[model samples]
Target: MASIDLAIAGLAIGAIAALSGIGLLVTYRTNGVLNLAQGGIATLIAYVYREMAVVWGLPVWLSAVLALAVLSPGIGVLLERLVFRPLARRRASAAESLVASLGVMVLTLGMCAGIWGLGAQTDTPAVFPNKSVGIGGHHVGVDTISTLIVILVACVSLGLLQSRTKFGRQMRAVVDDRQLAELSSVPADRVAAAGWAFGTTLAGFTGILLAPRVSLSPYSLSLVVLETFAVVVAARLVSLPAAVFAGLAIGILQSELTQFTVNGSLADIYRTLGSNLFVVVLLVLLLAIPNLRELGDAGSAGSFSSRGGQEDTGTVAERSKDLVWRVAGFVMLLAPMLFAPSDLRHAFMVPALALIFLSIVIVTGYSGQVSLGVAGYAGLGALFSLKLASGGMVGIPHLPGLLAILVGAILVAPIGLVTGYPAIRRRGLTLALVTFAVGAVVSRFVFEQPSLAGNLTVNPLYIGGWELGDKSFYVIELLGLGLGMLAVRNLHRGRLGRALLAVRDNTGGAAAVGVDVRNLKLLAFTMSSVVAGLGGALLAYSASSFSSDTFQPIQSLLWFTAVVVFGADSAVGAIVGAAFIVAIDVMAPSGSSTLAVGILALALGWLPGGLASAVRGVIRYVAEQLADQFVAPASPIRGISALAPAALPAGPGAVAPSSVGTKPAVASARASGSTAGVAAADRVAADRGLALTPFGRTLLGLVGGGGTARPTPAPARANGAGPGAAGDIDRHATVGAGDFGSRNHVEGGHR
Candidate 1:
């Protein structure tokens, strides 16, 4: 009876989860974009409903209708038209779309925080009454029953629409290939807009229904909705029924497990697991699921990398320009040391954050793997360093602060192997989801645990009998960064660099050419983790404390985006991104840096290779222009006369020009015994943009006395006109001239 009652009590949350899952699935199926912003949208709508009903004293029904119907769908339509439509038209990579969705998420969360403040709201309006009814030997709240009924109605309606409607088939076509569907005269944009609108409406409903059950807050409510992603993942992002079933099952299972109490050291662990069952399910499913059948092409991970500025060899002028840029960058980095002591301390994060960003460059930039859990590795490093320094961790000796950092980073390297093993099989979104789940799990279980990390202490770094001050510590950080840069440079050069590039460009092709793709991926992960761990340790030492919030899962997303926006493959870009973030935060409001990054990320379609690549292109162009100014131009060649040959040079190295309309000199060489010479002459002619006509070739052969070859007649044009008639035609021919004209002629004639 107790279990039955608990299950009944769980139905409200189960219904909300179902709604979220269905929303996610529908958006993905229709738009072919995994909407990471769904949770943010839900949180925003919930906040709006709370403001209208609870704060402004509006009617509950009116507030619900306004928030769920008008506001939610309006936001959806606006996003489809303004944010995602351009990306779709450009055929952007999956990674780009994912980043854009993340931008939307960040922007929405920032809006909610900026407007409503970060304070929690306890009183939220409920659409259904709190009354209860007795049924089947149990008392269930009216809200629970209402939620279940509403979900059922929504699901049934959605199922029928998807299965039996013309719009649904049109949506399917658009999802499969937007260009093809548009060519086939389908309204792809409208179908996509409708899908987003419907999906966001569901999100609003879920948020409103669930708000009354939990304290309404920007981050907490949004995180709760994010957990519902487990339901969609369990359904393979395809089937709505499967999503509904998974949501209900997990909710019921979670409620039922709360009935049992365990008294032991592992009791807290069990309770936490029971509470966060969805996270556990997510991690397991992502690890166990071998393949996901995504709509459209499964995009390559390497597409996220920049395309320009990868040249290994350059001229002296280019190399000198690079040197000047490096010097200027170093000057900028070191200038912070001249600030006030307090301000200098703030600048400590620059190098540490740059090192963390460089770790992303190692995995995503060099090796083409998407890792969304770098914060997990970083948080673990900080925890380990603190524990080791304080003598709290078992089986590890207490050590001085500097030594602890080294040992902690070395210990954390193996965790990258754990993440890398999954990356061996997964890629793109699946890999991203898996890494995010890992970070979320680590953050919840390890960092948030009072027994594990609550009392941990982080000490200032010291070197044998020397207590390091702020300036000394900053210098040490710079040294560590130099070492990381050295390692990256080595990785980007020689045979190893080429192999990693080959793997990144094309995995199957790399393997076909004998590259060990698996081992290389593992190595990249391990090295990246080491650098991230070192950076995390430095971060803790710089602040002289350990705070779990410093390495939250959301921070990882920001770091990844910042690295990509600056230039994923550019080390200098990573450093500049860190400086920019730190500088922006210091100069602006709390959430302003997030807003700035989000705006830039949303505009990534316009900047294909990121800020670093764009700068490099400008510099290279300038260098070429400057170099060209120093070189003298060549004298123009004298034209040959029609009736007479050109004068020959005085030396054997010079050759006489054939008369106009004669065969090219190279043709005479080919007719003679010097075919290789003809090949060489052809190369020189190509460099000079010289075209060899058949008549010219025959005349050259006769002039050189190599042969008396007859001239070959030109083929008739596609309009059945002779070569002479084709020649008489205007340069801008109509479509009737067919092959005699360019593509514009055909298009113009059709018009």
Candidate 2:
């Protein structure tokens, strides 16, 4: 009977989970967005509701109507119209849309934090009071019954609407082929808008109901909602009923598990699992699921517009010369080491965190794949190192840090491969959800498990015969980062680099060329995860401890956005990105880094390929300008021959003298020199062709060789100079040296 009561009590939580899952599925189905913002939105609305009812003195029902019915849905519709519509129209990659969703999540969280502060709100208004009714020796709370009823209603109504209504058919058509549906005249936008509104309303309702059961703090509530993602994944982002069932089973199972008695370590493990079983389930489901319905053509192509379309006009040799610039950027990273001792100590986080973000760059940037589960890999890396060092398992005693890192990397590689399998067929919002679900699972089950992670201790990496201090450890980090950059460079060059680029650009096209897309994708994921694990090991040592909060799933989201904004494919960019995040946190307020990242990520459309790409462009442009100036012809000789001796040498030699020719001869000698000067002037004019406008060319003719003189046909035609014999001589004298003279003349010298 007591067991039955606990099960009943669990059902209430299950019902709420089911409601959240159902809401997520609806949004994915109708609008094809997984709504990673769901949790953030829910938390935000809950706070709003609490403020309206508890502080603003609004009636409970009125507050609920305003929040759930008006404000929440209104927010969703506004986002769809303003933010998502433009993205959809431009056909943004799924990874980009996922970033946009993260942006929304960050924005909402910041807004909540700004409004209500980070403190917990325990006095949240509950829809149903603490009252119970007894049925067949089992007492159930009214809220529990109401929650179950609400879940049933939502499920049935959604199922009916999707399967039966005209609107449902149109939605299905649009989801199937948006362009085709538009040809069929279905109002896809209106249908999508309706879906967003409906999904958001459900989120608001779920938040209000769940708030009373859990403390209402922005992070905690949001995380709780995230944990329920297991329910959504179990449904494959499709069926409401399936999600509802998964939620209920997880809730009831968790409650039932509490009654079991066990030994201390095992008991702690069980308790943790009991509370977070859904997260474990979610992770397993995400990794195990074969395929998911993708949103549009997202995740199928590389996110960069300049990827293939832009010629590598910048050659590998040319690009390598830019390595000096990258070294300069790296030097900037080390600048902090020169700061005050206290600040220098904090700067150690830059390299360690940069290594972690480089993992993101390798997997997402280089491969054109999206990974939001990096934190999971990092946490696992930390966990493995701790466990190996402490010798927790049988027959395995404490190990050295270097050995622990190798083992940790090896362990994480398989996990990456496992996750990569799902990624091959899933993309965009589907992949984002899947990866996020995996992170949540690792966080709840592995990180939170006392038996696994609670008592684990991390040891420092050792080299031959020396213990590392903070500065020495930083040096080690630098070496690791150097190796990481080498690996990334290798990945981005040669056959492997081309193959990854091929896969990223066009999977089908790449496979057609026998590129083995699947193997390459798996290889990238494995390598990336191993690097991430090493970074995680470093991060643990830097902190000198392992805490669950250090590897929260939200951190993964933040890391992903940072890498994307910094330039996904650039290792140097990854380092700069890490430094930027660390510097912001050190210099500004705590949450300001996220705020800055959010704003920059929102500007992704304008800054294409992120800030790294923009910086590369600026550098490239400057380099080109410098190259042009270095190779450009020396300035045209002007106003120099005017001060020269008359009848200058025709071609660097004295003119011949003749008697009949002497009189007419010196006349022709002078004429020949003028023609020579005019021809030189023409050559100079053509050399400056790039700078000349049609108007400038006309002006050049008006400033003809010399004033008030004309050259006759003999020498003038021979030199390809027209009928301005005297004018040509005057122009030559007006300019330095003859127009056709050698370029090595003085600024105003005719010699």
Candidate 3:
């Protein structure tokens, strides 16, 4: 009977969870995006409501109406028009959409942190009074009753809207085939905009109701909203009824579990499980479920890092710029060392963060796994290293710093493989959800567990039988980073690299071609975990302590978004992203880096393959200009008698050199030091050939020698000055260097 009271008390939480899930389902069904930003949207609106109602002293009802009726939905429309519309028009894959969603999430968190500050606000205005009334000898809160009504009304309204309306059919059509719907004049964009509006409206409602229940803070409130994802995942991301039922049942069960009492670690584990049942269920459901009714291609995991049909090896011009990029990146990395002692201490985090970012590069970039759990592995690395160094683990002796880190990283490799087994048959958003679930589970079950992570401490690490200073430790960090880079390079090169690429590009084709797809995926996961573990260990060492909050589940989203914005596949991008994060955090306000990353990620539509690819394109253009400075044009020139008849373009479009009224006698004068003959050829060129067509001008720009002059015919050369003479043009050997940024390898080889 007491359990009934607790279950009733839990109704308020269940109702809001239901709304969150239903909102996610509506957006995904209509727009084919998982709306990873749903939680952030909710958090942002919550802050807005608090500001309007509490801070500004507006009436609660007015604040709620303005927030839900206007501001929240406006954000949805703005996001649709600004961030997502271009991607949808271009038919961006789920992986790309997922990154954009993360961008929104990061942007909203940044906005909240920037404005409200991160302190917990217990003064969130509640729409309903805090008092409860008796119902048949049981107490029920006004908030719970109001939420129950809202959930029921919201669900029934949505069901009718999605079924009994023309807009509903349009939504389904757009989701089924947006381009085809547009061809049929179905107003797909409008339908998508409507879907986003409706979804975000529900998100706002949930946030308004939820703010009073939880402490209003940027990260905590958003994380609470994310935890509700179990509702939709349990619904198989399709059925609204299933989501509602699952939400209520989980909520009640969690509430009911409080009655049970036991002792020992098993009892402690059970209690923790009850509190985090949503995360546990999410992980189980993701693993147990065979397949979801996802909208994108099954092998679309590599789509975010897609090279946009560009070749992997690229033009010779592109290759030439690599050395320059490499040098600049090296300088960027080393600049931190010359900083003042305090600044250098802060910069220790740069290399450590780079290693973690590199792990993401290996897993998501090289293999297209779309892992959002590298933070989980990284956290494990930190814990394992600390445990090893402190001799906290059973039957294990304390080791030196470097050795413990290595062993801890080695131990974490198998764990990554074990966790990644689910990825053996998953990709794209489905795989992303699976990895995120695994991460959430690990965070709750391991890192947050008091027995494992409580009051942990270790001595300063010694290197080579001596304790090192700050600068020396930084050098050690650099060495570790170099080793990690070498490993990434090896993974991205040779037969193994090609095989991983094959798996990423097309798993079925790779299997057809006899590539062991499963083994390669497992290898990628193992290697990625190793790198993350190393980085996580270094991260702990830098702080001289292990802290669970540092590796929160939300950190994974931030790191993944940053890596993709900087170029997921390039190791150099990881270093730059690390530098950017550390630098931005150091120089500016706390959340400024997050805001910048969010802006850059949202702009990923124009900057395909992220900043790294954009930079490479620019360098390739400059390289082409340099090549043009030296190499002669590859195409034939007319109106020059030094050129043989065979050298002229033979097509009908070709104009006869004789039409320009130029004579053959100009050949000798043009080929030698005679100024008069050169003038005659220049006159003809100025009248006709000097004014190049667009294609010819572009070719000349890329390969610059002898604009209108051609190599003298063998007989004509014999009659003129020797090859060493002043007017003699040495034949340009670089014939095919005209096309700048030309792709040289197979198109779209997993980027």
Best by lDDT: 3
Residue-by-residue lDDT tens digits, candidate 3, 513-614? 456888889999999999999999899888887888778888898999999998888787899899899889889887788788888988887776788778
**TM, every model:** 0.82, 0.76, 0.84
Candidate 2 residue lDDT tens string, 393-494:
466677777777668766898998987887777656657767777787788778987766777766666778577777777777787778778888878775
Model 3 accuracy (lDDT, Cα): 0.76
Sort the candidates on TM-score, descending order.
3, 1, 2
On the 0 to 100 scale, the lDDT of residue 642 in model 1 is: 18
Which run of 10 residues does model 1 get worst, by summed lDDT?
699-708
Candidate 1 C-alpha error for residue 16, in Å: 1.3
Q: Residue 311: error of model 2 in Å?
A: 8.1
| Whole-structure CA lDDT of model 1 | 0.74
Give per-residue CA lDDT, model 1, range 1-751, as digits (tens).
4889889877767778988998898899999988988877898999999999988999999999999889999999999999889989988778778878887877777777767876788889788887899998789888878777877887898888878998878988999999999999999999999989989999988889878878787767877788788999999999888998999899888888899988877787778888888888888999999657766656665555564313232234335545644665587589988989999998998888888998999998888788888998888888888889998879887998878887888888899987889988887888888888898898888888887889877666668888898899889889988988998888876568756765665566556545688999999999899889888988888777888878877778778888888878777788888888888888876766777777777777777657765676677678668768976764333322211212222243333222122234543564354769665554444333232321211111111111111222223122334433321111111111111222222220121
